[model samples]
Target: MEAKKVALVMVDISGYTHFIRAQKVSAIHAEEIVFELLEAVIDRAEYPLTLNKLEGDAVFLYAEIGDNNLARVTRDVAKQVQGFFEAFYDRARTLTEERAECGCDACSRVHDLRLKVLLHSGEAVFRQIRQFEELAGEDVIAIHRLLKNDIPAREYILMTDAFHNLAGNLAGMAYTPSQQTYPDLGTLQIHVFQPSN
Candidate 1:
């Protein structure tokens, strides 16, 4: 492994903390549901994605050595990520509708369920070290910046240009625009979160 060819993932569920603070059951329910959905995707996919852990209503993940490269765009990675978000988002939408029908007091306040997915290509792997994951470089930093400073307020599946560049010749991907400006951080693009119909 010259450099760990991985897709650094940082996905978050909106209103996670607020739900946790207001109701334990809702928070727990939210976590379980989200985790289950994520876990299923990771499990079913043949790509190199893994479940790092479930933190609050957020799931930290990473996809390892798939079709990511710097030749063209992340045709494979983008499609997989977009598909995952759409699937989960669709399910999340169903969950929201169900809550209204169930009239569950705890879940009533959850007006929306959205995810922010950040995928980065970098060098390093964290495998049962019981120690830590090394991400001390520009690649990791750029990803953080994309998620924190670049992505829109309410968007889903925003990927770094680094990932897209690796798509190689594959085409047909619709991503949103990035609000933050980071010209030095390679090609940064944000897919304006849309659930697949």
Candidate 2:
């Protein structure tokens, strides 16, 4: 089968469960608020958003914003991700500094979510099964590892080499070393944004 171009992204928050664990209110309520905030962020972006499976504090997302030239498709995906991270960070920061303008769900839970965005692009088999987006094989697996190994808890965006190579704005952005293990591939290297800690 011929391979299709796709980017597999994984978004998750740091200190999410810990925040709920220490909360006086119900954990479900706290989690629900975070989930709602995440949903709104994705919805506002208008990027193809699909939730596959939730992994603890993490949320799996598959975004396909229509197809364009393969190169442009990948770069745009990175830009879209970068933009989303900035927007989310701004929202969270405003809430933290007590400058939040809205009293909505996002503002309320803004302090609870610190998002880590990971992007990995490669060839894949994309099949729309009913209301689901199912992508399988090494491409999918590779992207998952890219997200897992590259993105740190506090860092905003981590892009695999394939993604960085195609992303338009690389020269100005900082890059840091990222190494990880894959099922059969053993050790691999990628790039991650340096946390300005």
Candidate topping TM-score: 2
Query: For model 2, what is the error of residue 62's alpha carbon versus the real structure, in angstroms, after optimal superposition?
Result: 4.2
For each candidate, C-alpha RMSD in Å? 4.6, 4.7
Model 2 spans > 4 angstroms off: 1-3, 47-59, 62-68, 90-112, 128-130, 150-153, 168-172, 195-197
TM-score of candidate 1 on Cα atoms, chains taken together: 0.66
Determine the backbone clash count of candidate 1.
12
Q: What would you estimate as the lDDT of candidate 2?
A: 0.62
Clashing pairs for model 2 are none
Q: Which lDDT tens digits does candidate 2 get at residues 59-85?
A: 666554334665666666666666666
Q: Give the TM-scores of the predictions, in the order they appear.
A: 0.66, 0.72
Q: How close is candidate 2 to the true structure, as a TM-score?
A: 0.72
- State the lDDT of candidate 1 residue by residue for 19-60, as single tens digits: 556666566665555565566446544454566655555556
